[model samples]
Target: GSLEHTAVLALVLAMALTAAAPALCFAALAVAAGGLGTAVFCPGERRSGAAVFTAGCALGALAAPNLTGVLTLGLAAGAGLLGFLLCPEQALRAVFPPPATPVGTQSLTSAARKLSGVADTLSDIAETVNAVCSCQMPPRGESYDYVVEFCAQHLCQNCARRNTCWVQGYSTAMDGLYALRGALEHNGRVELEDLPGQLSTCVHPADLCATVSHGYRLWCSRRQTRARAELLRTALTEQYSAMATALAQMAARLGRAGLPDPRREARTTQLFASLGLEPLECTVLTDLAGRVTAAVTLPRTSFTPGECRALAEEMGRICRRDFDPPEVTNCRTVTMLHFGERPLYRAVFGLASRPAPPETVSGDACRQFCDSAGRAQMLLCDGMGTGKPAAVDGQMAAKLTAQLLQAGFAAESAARLVNVALGLKNAGQESGATLDLLTLDLYTGRAGLFKAGAAPSFLCRAGVVRTLDGASLPMGVLPTVTGRSTALTLDVGDTVMMVSDGALCDGSAWLCDQLTLSTRLGQSPQQTAEAVAASAVRRSGARQDDITVAIVRLERQKS
Candidate 1:
């Protein structure tokens, strides 16, 4: 309370009322002030602001004060303090409150515009490149000119009968030469008797046929190369167009502002004020999914865990929605609180790996983490063979996959990108690896399994075990990668088991049995994974390979 400011306000009122019956005016003012204080200080009360103001006016008209004015003011102040302490809400509302205005959109619009412009530029470039690439396609097949050109440059160059075949009898020589194309294309070579009369009478007919055959093969190889290059160009153009479209969509989403609730904001503010912390700003934003997020900025203060939980519960009740615990960020002068919607489920992961016999390093790698959207990802990569070289490939694939997924890349897209990276890592030598990816959406309890030349995985629901397998080539084997994906809804206590091919050298029957047993016994994910890996190695005997096993279990999140 500003005591000096209050005194100044009272003096100003007294001076203004001195010319119009000062004593009676002062008495009415005193009663009006007391009733107004009582109404203003009582937070969370349902009385209309106009009703409170009218009641104050009525009390002023009926009451008169003289020497008892001091006692009346003291009692009013005490009652106001008591009401402030007792009321859970601490907001102060005027009789005519201003309209509620939205936040964040004004500041976000500029950034969204810039991003949209960049996306448009990219889209335009992609369209232009795609149009150009589509227009300039490589020739479909081997051309007739290649054989003639090859024969003229290589065979007829140093022949003694070059003049007879070129200048004097150019037309006859061209017909005889063109006739060899059919023979060479059909049989991959031309015999002496297959040539026309003009070419049959050459100084060396056998040599000419051989030369034509070689030239045709060369022309076919060049055509194939050009076709491959064209295909690559088309693929790149499509990728650019897709990237531009994704960016544009992202910008549009960012530009779309979520609705703000003024009632929720006021309640949140008052809640903080009741906790002895006056919020500098309070905003409640709701997304298209109907999830509410309340952001409150308050003067810097220490918040304990219990207080945060209680505050979150209170806020949830105030907004009539369930919210996760608040994420707190403190600055020098203020603390920011953000409360989002809680997920429906939680997934736990466990992994176990072992190197091959006589090897110290394992060729299999794995990574498990939750993405920004709360989707849990499990990546298991197995390289071609055991040892350091294989370890490098496995690690690279797993790392790249994790990073791409975390950066919002789709599962298939991330796997394709990792394949291209591995293929380009080494120039001449061939390298390949199997990639197994499992993604679980905690909010929806949907699980997706993506495999690239990986071994079959087992899904254990209740007491039954089901095998998930797909036919695909390993990454780095070709310029393009092939993969298979499956989606299924998961429930509480459902477990997913994944293993490398090396672990199933004997067969998948044992692995399936192991998964079933683990599920029946209700073992922890870690224990189940370790048991699977150990059983696999024991079954392999002396011819052991690099073994890796990963497990995921879904459970309902505790309230």
Candidate 2:
């Protein structure tokens, strides 16, 4: 058979198949290219794997669209084939893939499991965060089962400064455990430097005491222990005056009883009793689609399982206040999904912006994140201008970036993923957004800020403000990007503020002054956001750009 004649006939056939099955046609063309390359590169070698990979890439290109996507896929297919011819192992590795950047644990298995284990529970954080639902009770009798496990857990135990030192201890312990396990299992595949620095999360005021308090509250209700719990509660409050003081001292001084110390349990019992707060453990989850599926574990109530079903439904609504989902369902049992209040912190966001025409939507968008590992992230995007066109660019940047972060991707990886996605989305069109991302460790009040062509963000701690400015160009405008990232420390009563150019028109110095004043005045995060937006609007006198301000405060909780 003459290959030239066959190539011509195959091209004609592919052209015909494009109308009925474009994806298949693409696959065939990619296979043809890869097969030819393999045959020429390594005459006696088998390259079936490379051919399959090429076909898969072609199918992926169909889903990705754009000339950039198709070209990238074509190049990859060619490279895969060539690589298979030269080194089959490397080619196979590319198709099979390996574990992503490790989280610093020792066991390859544990780290891998941490990355891909609990497949049904959470495959991607971005998808899960989006699924944060405000699901009202579904039609009664409709039910779904979720196997939830606490993917990560940390406890700063036995600390004179439990609240203060516990965070670091937990971080060290988790990191070391992983490092040791990884050494034993993966033989140097995982790196501690690659592991996440720490764990963080946010909890409600009622859940302040969490595990310790829940046990105490339950213990107090018994008629025999009511008098003792009440006395203990009063005494515990006397030890700490304010919530801030309580948080610090509790971390430093609190301990539960075990061995020789008979008073250990009693000590916790009294402390939790004084808090007068209830404990409800809930975490955000995602279904197959990127919708929020909040997993909650109800405490043991005297009510029977049948009776608790209705009660659980009612309580479910209250738990989902942070996530706005359309419907909520319940598993009519004492379900214990993996959840803990480690490294707790509360996150809040606010925006104030006007469109260029005042008819179209503003260009800036803010995304609040509850990523895996109890981490909270605030991602802000501002497009080129203040109109619908700008809004689209900004929304894409914010959303895609957020999803990547939620999916357990690091900031750098997330940025790259967003870049590729945007490059494919707006091939010939010019679209871009200034993205500002800040991740706060709830446990330690440490913040990491990453920027891509964004304005400066502020950090307000103890009434003192610090400014962090951006250092990169906007995303979507570039084929590849690695924005600036820096670590900043926060202590008790710290607030991180982000604003668009419109908000800064009043001047960064002036904005800093205002934030410091707000902190001194003890303004809440929402109130501060409103005040900042109001000031920006006042400065513009109604003629303004799309201005957005986000405030995230780390509060030390009191029992």
Tell me the whole-model lDDT of each prediction, alpha carbons only: 0.72, 0.53
For model 2, residues 181-265, the per-residue Cα lDDT tens digits are 3332343222333333332232222222243233322322343244434433543343223223323432332121011211221
- At residue 435, candidate 2 shows an lDDT of 77
Off by over 4 Å in 1: 1-90, 93-262, 265-289, 293-339
Q: Which pairs clash inside model 1?
A: none
TM-scores, each model vs. reference: 0.56, 0.43
- The number of clashing residue pairs in each candidate reads 0, 40
Model 1 per-residue lDDT tens digits across residues 1-559: 1223334555565456555566657444654464445345542343453345345544554454554754554465457556745654323342212223246432332233334344444454345435533654443434778889998999899998888879999999999988887788789888887988867668888888889988888888777666656556645654555455445555565546367877677656666766788766676777677767677767777789987888788888988876666766565676767666667888889999989978999999999887535588998999888899899888878876776665555677667666655654532247778999999998888989999999999999987899999999887676667899999999999999989988888999988888888888889999999999998888888778999999999989887
Give stretches of model 2 more than 4 Å off: 1-336, 348-353, 541-543
Task: Give the root-mean-square deviation of each candidate in angstroms.
Answer: 11.2, 34.1
Worst 10 residues of 1 by lDDT: 90-99
